[model samples]
Target chain A: MRIAFAGNPNSGKTTMYNALTGRSEKVGNWGGVTVGSKEYPIKEEYTGGKEVVAVDLPGAYSMSPFTPEEGITSEYVRTANPDAIVNIVDATNLSRSLFFTTQLLELGIPVVVALNKSDINEKEGTKIDVKKLSEKLKCPVFETTSTEGKGLKDVISNAIELVGGGQSAPYVQADINLQNKAEVDAEDRKRFSFVNDIVANVEKREMLSSETTKSDKLDGVLTNPIAGILVFAAVMWAVFWVSQAWLGPLVADWLVGWIETFQEWVAGKLENSPAILSALLADGIVGGVGAVVGFLPLVMVMYFLIALLEDCGYMARVSAVMDPIFKRVGLSGKSVIPVVIGTGCGIPAIMACRTIRDERERRATSMLATFIPCGAKIPVIALFAGAFFAGAGWVSTLSYFFGLLLIFLGALLIKYITGYKYRKSFFIMELPKWKMPSLKFAFKSMMERAKAYIIKAATIILICNTVVQIMQTFDWHFNVVEEGAENTSILASIASPFAILLIPLGFGVWQLAAAAITGFIAKENVVGTLAVVYGLTAFIDVDELEMTGGANNVAMATGLTSVTALAYLFFNLYTPPCFAAIGAMNSEMKSRAWLWGAIGLQLGTGYTVAFLIHQFGTLFTEGHFGNAFIPGLIAVAIMATAVILIGRKTRAHFDEKYRLHRDGKSGAAA
Target chain B: MLLNAEPGKTYTVKEINTDDEEMNSFLFRLGCYVGEPITLISKKKKSCIVAIKDGRYNLDELLSSAIIV
Candidate 1:
């Protein structure tokens, strides 16, 4: 039997679903976190012995959908033939929630109203007489706090028992023309009045929702245009600092020690094996994968912090704070959520774009969101910071600061290129009441992400590392290349051409080029392949680097100056994310032209930024331009020319369209 | 008018004047239609936080101006 969970956005549907199904699907304090439907078998504890599957649908305000995700929810409950529907209602907002509840009750499917977030209502001195509400709605109603796992079993069991029992809606709309707006509006108003009448009968409140509350006072400060932006910057900086420079490295030092011991044990075991076999096993697999995995603590900590931030209802306020600035660039406050999520990972970040109402803004957000360095790029950032910059906090700080700057510039460029003119863009976001962020949820989220990180390290990064190691070891003739003759190896031969184009960016060696190319497969591969090619496994141990003076050794092994190393770091950080992220961009963009344009913009931006950094840093430090400056300038010039040409063509097209529209209007008047 | 409404005071929504039909109906579903009470909790330079029914929403100036209170 299938029991579908449906409700208004942020009404704890996913939380209840996660509790019943024991599945850690994304649950955030904001709405539209679940853009797609998910089905998982109910846990044995919830089901007793009956086999039940819970279909967790995206939240919808009504059966008549507003957003795409809302459409998914309404369509699923209508057509999917679910045996029962569990309409999770926010008890705090009974008047608004019951509008959808009534619609759900009319579907003939049995609906057990889960009065979720009743705990919030209780704290606010609000009371909903459950028996009275159930009697009025003619359905079973249970008070549930999905966060604490309260009353879930009762809700689930009641839903299961009513699997095949048909529902009878308490208030039904009068027969009216479905196509007429007036009829629909009049009927909807009547239905709302019915819901309001029930609310008036069943709910008693000591505090009105509209009265000024503590949360509103807090919002006054946090959503201030000037103070809010600074607070946002400081909060983001604190997250990065704690995860990268302070707490993260402190934990990583211990983890890297264990990883190094394991690497040594593997090497000890392979002592009797052939040199080729030993290198492939000990250095290629264990060393390379371990180097990537060593940064797991950093990424996990970041995920935990981000999850907490998402849980605390601050993101909605941040969006409201950023809407004006984002609007100036042709995006809206809704675009802020995706970029914030992008800091955790790009795929879900891009997926979050579905909540955005504007198509152009959504696509632009998906394309530009990845400019914020994600969890995968943490290893790359840490490696460069440790090796060249002595693990400076400014390195990571500058990376994210530049990332945001690039996103702003990129959005503006896209706005101009796409010829998006000023339109009346409406910004409205529900400010979910703030509560203490759950550490349990944060820990669960951290573990989920950690598991993904390890699996990715074991599979994609391992394969790429092994391939890189083998290619660097053997020449075109399939013979092992001797020391100092590594240029003859297959990897060198393949990466050399790309290296020529990267000469002006400094660090134009085939090894660095190969790492950058493999980064396209997965961003972590940059660290893994770097470890494989350089035969270094100690990228995460900054304390060891300092104590043993090994930081200089690692930097020397890569044969890059500090200036060039910073350039290379920027190159990897700003370029297109992994292929999976590109696939997400493609799906969100849904336009081949836009997809190609996004990739071109990212590539040009990365190259141009790196080239300028290298050239200017060289001039400042050594009093000369970086290598191949003329060629790099030509390349940047070509890209700039292409962008300008596209912008001009787009402007001309808009003008022509505008002229034609005006002419047609005048002609009609004539 | 919603834009000039005093904070901490409740007023009934007179109308929503946006041309966008979907946004209009969406707001209607949230109990922000004509004669529904909306309370302005706070107002900022660019946006204002309002309470419609039991939910608080931050609306930009443009959207706030469109809601005739």
Candidate 2:
């Protein structure tokens, strides 16, 4: 049996689903966090040994969808014909939630209204007669606090009993022409009146929602036009500083020490084996995977902070504060959510774009959000910042700020290229009540992500590193390349061509080019491949390296100046994201043209930015342009000319199309 | 005149004036319709926060302007 969990956004459905199924799907305070539906077998404790599946659908306000994600919910409930519907309704907002409840009842599906967030209502001195509400709606009602797992067992047991049973709706709309807008509106008004009548009878409140409250006062400062922006910047800066500069490295140092010990143990255990076997097993597999895993502390700490922010209900306000500014770039404040989420990862960030109502805005957001350097890129940033800049905090800070600059520039370029004029774009977001962020929830979220990180290291990173090790070890003739003749290996030969193209951006050696190439598979490979190729066991041990002359050893191995290093870092940061993220972009944009154009834009931005940074940095420091300056100039000029030419053509096309529309309007008037 | 309305005051929704039918219906489903008591919780230069049917929502100027009170 499949029991579908459906309701309003942020009503704690996913939390309940996670509890019932023991799956850690994303849950945030803001609306539309879960853009897609998911299903899992109910935990044995909840199902009592019965084979049951729980389907968690995206939230929808009404049967008629407003956004694409909402459509998923309404369509699934209408067609899938689940055995029962567990409508997770916000108890505090029963007046609006029941409007959908009544519609669900009309479908003859057995619905057990999970009155979620009743705890919040109780705190506010709001009382709801659950028995009376159940009586009126003709369904079982269980008051639940999904965050705490309260009343879940009762809700599930009652829902299990209702399976295959009949549900009779107490109030039903009179037969009418549903296709007619006026008829639909009239019926919806009657339905609202029905819900209102029931609410007035069963509910009493000491504090009205409209009245000014303590939270509103907090919002006055946090959502203020100017102050809010500054606070947001400060908050983001603090998150990065604490994770990257302060707490992250402390934890990482301890972890890396363990990894180095393990590598030594493996090397000792395989001392009698073939020379190649020890290098492959101990150095290639363990060292490469260990290098990637060393950054887990940084990523996990960042996740914990973001989870707390999400749980506290500040995400909505962040969007509210950034909305006006985002709108100027032809995107909405809602776009900010994805960009912020992109800081952690790009796949879900692209999925978050489903909440935006405007198609163009949604596509543009997905295209540009990846510019915000995700968790996987943190290792690259840290490696470069430590090796080249003495681990200065400004290096990480500057990367983020430069990323924001690129997003803005990318949005404007896209706006012109698409020729989208001002339309009547309106923004509305439900402001969830603020509360103390749950520390336990944040810790759980962090642990879950850490598990995923380790699993990835053991599987994909392990395989890729092993392959990279072997490819660099042998020539095309299957003979191990002679020492000091590494350039003849297959890996070096294939990467040399791409290296030629990257000379304008500095650091154009085949090894650097190979790392950048594998980066398309996963961003962490940039760090992992470098560790394997350079034979460095620990990039995080930079202070020790500086002491033992290993810092210059690494600089000699990679052959990058400070300027070229920064340029290479930015190039990897802004380039088209990993293939998994590209798949997400394809799914969300659902347009081949938009997906290709997005890739083109990313490639161009990465190349142009890296080229300028390298050449300019060299000019200022050494009083001359970098190598291959003329060829780089020609490449940049060709891209700029292509953009200009495309912009003119798009403008002309829009002019002709709109001119025809205007002529038609005036012709009709005449 | 929602955009020009005083904050912390309740007013009846007179009408929804917009060319976008989907947005109009979306708002209506949220209980912001004719005769519904909508309260202006706060106002900003470009947007305003409003309360409708036990929910607080921030609306942009273009949207609030279309909601006559």
The complex in candidate 2 yields a DockQ of 0.85
All models: lDDT?
Answer: 0.91, 0.89
Candidate 1 structure lDDT: 0.91
TM-score of chain A of each: 0.97, 0.97
Poorest 10 consecutive residues of model 2 chain B by lDDT? B42-51
Model 1: share of real contacts kept: 0.97
Q: List where candidate 2 sits over 4 angstroms from the true fold.
A: A542-551, A655-670
Q: Interface RMSD for every prediction, one decimal?
A: 0.8, 0.8
lDDT by residue for model 2 (A1-670), tens: 9999999988899999998998999999988999999999998787778888999999999999999999999999999999999999999899999999998998898999999999999999999999999999999999999888899988888888999996899888899998899998898899999989999999999999889777777776777889999999999898888888778877887888899889999999999999889989998999999989988998999999999999999999999988898888889989999988998899999999999999989999999999999999998997887778876677888888788888888888888887876578899999998868999889999999899888988888888888888888899998998899999988899899999999999978888998898898999999888877777767776344232343455566798999999999999999999999999999999999889989989999999999999999999999999999999999999999988888788777777777697874322110
Candidate 1 C-alpha lDDT tens digits along A545-575: 3424546667888989999999999999998
Clashing pairs in 2: none
